[model samples]
Target: MSIKNRLIAMNFFQFFVWGAWLITIANFWFGTKQWEGTQFGLVFGTMGIASLFMPTLTGILADRWINAEKLYGILHILYALVLFYLPQIETPGNFIYVMLLAMCFYMPTIALSNSISYTALKNSSDSDVVKDFPPIRVWGTVGFIAAMWLTNLSGNKATAYQFYIAGIAAILLGLYAFTLPKCKPQHTKAEKSSFAESLGLEAFKLFGTYKMALFFIFSMFLGGALQLTNAYGDVFLDEFKNVPEYADSFVVKYSTIIMSISQVSETLFILAIPFFLKRFGIKQVMLISMVAWVLRFGLFAYGNPTDGLWMIITSCIVYGMAFDFFNISGSLFVETSTNAKIRSSAQGLFMMMTNGFGAVLGSFTSGWAIEKYFTHDGERDWHNIWLSFAAYSLVIAIAFAVLFKHKHNPNDVANVSH
Candidate 1:
């Protein structure tokens, strides 16, 4: 296979591992295991906990000691092992611990995958990393959607088989990673060196800048917005099964498949980033994303699988903008703003904020808020829950618009494509 094809496959299996279980895991938790809400929230927070350190630690290893592909392969294999063991655990505490281990192995690989891809693409004689990589990355979402469809169609949406599916895909990708192009450590003997620098801690200096510090803070806040839907969206649809008329609806039967539409939208929105970034600049593009988040939650506040199905579908569609606008554009912003020496670490820092701290904050707080304010008589008030979330996003968007200050430079936007 050609280099692009190889990278595409890598990206595909990369997310396929995640898609198999992420959306449907709530079913396995709340539906199959009948776990408590607070614990379930902690379960999702595992990604945050893992992201808190593993990405930076691995980034250090990839930047200094190990080949990025080798490290990526090792983590995937470890992740597969943990995932395979997950079904045997009967308690929520054990499940959380095991899943946390799995995430420790899994989360860092996200950043590593990007590093490997960027390196391989940059090494290709005729390739442009910026222009070519997004197209390749879109397949990762395709892989995610494919896995979601597979789980939903096979009647494994609420079973341990979801973890098995993810495990199998992760192992396959682990082996496949070994065949990818090398991404050797960039650190050299000639460069000034210290223990902290060697460990990629220098990237923390970005926090000293008012712009980067505020950007990361907002990234955390938005990161909280992300998994709210992922954790509850499918369950939200599944709950409609309690209503007589909606009981037989396609959404109740195929909630995972319906949720896959968000990933489908991601593939398209990822392609539009370059154009949007060029025209509106990062600040405006991100503002658009925050606003989209408000709409995403607001629409969900009133949507149903029947008469309000359009609202649900539209919310799913808006998710692409809400998600990609911040994630992709934010990564690009980090890339453009940071020095090359600390780029990998900076990416890790960004992941730490959104996926790490943001995830923990979102998971715990949402769980608490839902249990405290949104639940009554053993039923969740999803309408008010979604409205509350929408209000949260609106507040963040307004604050961001007033606080973040960056002027668009045409040359900077143009440079991304080159």
Candidate 2:
């Protein structure tokens, strides 16, 4: 296979492992197990908890001791082992620990995957990472969409089969990772580094800068919003089955497929990031994403499978921008700004903020808030649930506008692509 095809395959299964279950796991938790909302929230929180430390720790290893591909492969194999063990657990409380273990092995790979892809593209002769990476990354979204469709069509969305599919795919990807081009550690001991710098802690200095610091802080706030839909979107639509009027609706029957539209939207939006990031600065593009988030949640608050279905559809479409703008742009921002030696660690820091602290904040708080305020009598008031989320997003957008200070340097945007 050509280098591009190999990277494409890598990106495809990278997200495929996640797409198989991330959105639909709520169905397994709430529908299959009928667990408590708070515990279920912690289930998503596992990714956040793992992201808090694992990504940074692994980033250090990748920078210092291990080849990126080798580390990436090892994590996915460990992840598959944990996932294979998932269906055996019978309770939500017990599920959290195991899920956290799975996430520890899985979350860092996301950052590592980026490091791997970026390294491969930059190494390829005559290739432009800015121009080439987005196209390759789009397959990851395609992979995610494919997994959702498979889980839903195979009659396994609410069953343990989703974990099996993910586990099997993960094993395949893990083994495949070993065959990919080498992504060796950039920092070697011959540099004569100090203990702190030796640990790849140099990237942490990005926090000392006001711009990067505020950027990560807002990334955390938005990260809090990221999993809300993944945690509840499917169950929200599936809940319509309780109403006789909408019980037979297409959405209620195939909520996972419908939710996959967001992933579909991601593919298109992922392509557009290069344009948006270039035309506007990272800050402006991110501001647009925050606004899109408001519309996304606001639309969902009123959407139904019937007359209000357009709102639902629109909300899903909005998700692509709401997600890709921040995540892809933020990563590019990190890539362009940071020192090459610490880039992996810097990417891990970004993941830590968005997926780690942000995810934990979003998961734990949203879970508690929803149970306390919007859920009653074993039913969720999704409208209020989404509206409150919209309000949270709006606040973040406004704060970001006032606090973040960066002018669109065409050269910096130029750095992202070249």
Candidate 3:
């Protein structure tokens, strides 16, 4: 295969491994194993725990010692091994430990994938990477959607077998990674520096700036909103089956497929971001995201599998705005605002706030709320659960609108155009 095709395939399997189980695993926990709600919170929070430091540690290893592609391959292989063992584990505590280990290996590859792609494209003689990569990266979202659909169609959405599917894809990608063009380590030799500097700790300097600090702090809060729906949306839809009128609806019967619309919309909306950012600037773009989150949850709060199907559909569509608006725009904000020397590390820190800390907070709090207020005799009170989440989003939105100060400069937006 050509280099482009190889990279695309890598991106496909990258997300395919995640898509196979990420959204549907709550069903596996709730329906199959019948685990406690708090246990599921801990299980989902493993991603957040791993995200706390795995990416930075792995990035250091890739930069200073190992070839990027080789480390990527190794991580995937380890991740696949963990996935293979997941089906055999019966207890939630054991499951959480294994998943944490799995995430430790898996999360770093998200950044590594970008690193490898940028390296490959920069080295290529035929194309300019800046112009070529966005189009190529779109295929990653396509792969993610395909995996979600496949999981639903294969009857693995609510089964441990979703891990098996993700595992197999990960292993295949691990082997395939060896054949890709090699990415060299960034460091040639050890050099003396401050304790923080040696650890890629210079990224912390951004915390000294008031605006950067607030942006990151709010990013963490918003990041909390990011994973709550993914962890519970399918299970929420499936919960409607307990109601007599909606028990037999198509949505309750196939919640995974219905939820995949969010991914589909994500791909479509990502293309519009350049235009949106150009017109509104990052602050307004982020505000739009916060509002989208409110709608995303409120719709779910009011939606049902039968009569309120449109609300559910609207919730899924708004997810595109909620997710992409924050993540992509946040990345652009970092790209534009930070110095070149610590750009990669700064980006990693941004992810740490949103995905790492944010995910942990979201999973644990939402889990606790669901258990306390939304469950009665093991049946879910999805209406109240979703309403609580909507309220949380509203708080975050209001806080961000008042706290995050960025002047919308038409020229700054124009820079992205050129």
- lDDT of all predictions, in order shown? 0.90, 0.91, 0.83
C-alpha-based local distance difference test score of model 3:
0.83
* Root mean square deviation (Cα) for candidate 1: 1.2
Better of 2 and 3 by TM-score: 2
User: Looking at model 1, which ten-residue stretch has the lowest summed lDDT?
Assistant: 409-418
Question: Predictions ranked by lDDT, top down?
Answer: 2, 1, 3
Per-residue lDDT of model 3, residues 258-317, tens digit only: 998898888877777777877888999999999999999999989887678999999999
- Give lDDT tens digits, candidate 1, residues 1-418: 9999999999999999999999999999989999887788998899999999998888878877788899999999999999999999999999999999999999998888877777787678888766787889999999999999999999999999999999999999999999999888887868887887865688898899998899999999999999798889989989999889999999899998888889999999999987888788999999999999999999999999889999999999999999999998898788778655665677788989999999999999999999999999889999999999999999999999999999998678656443
Q: Write the per-residue lDDT of candidate 2 for residues 1-418, one digit (tens) a residue.
A: 8889999999999999999999889888877988877788898899999999999999988988899999999999999999999999997778999999999999999999998888888888867777788889999999999999999999999999999999999999999999999999899777988778976799899989999889999999999999787788898999999999999999999999999999899999999988898889899999999999999999999999999999999999999999999998888899998866887899999999999999899899998999899888988898999999999999999999998999998788677544
TM-score for candidate 3: 0.92
Q: How many backbone clashes does candidate 3 have?
A: 0
Give the runs in model 2 whose Cα sits over 4 Å from its true position. none
Query: Which candidate would rank higher by lDDT, 1 or 3?
Result: 1
Q: What is the lDDT of residue 350 in candidate 1?
A: 90
- Residue pairs clashing in model 3 are none
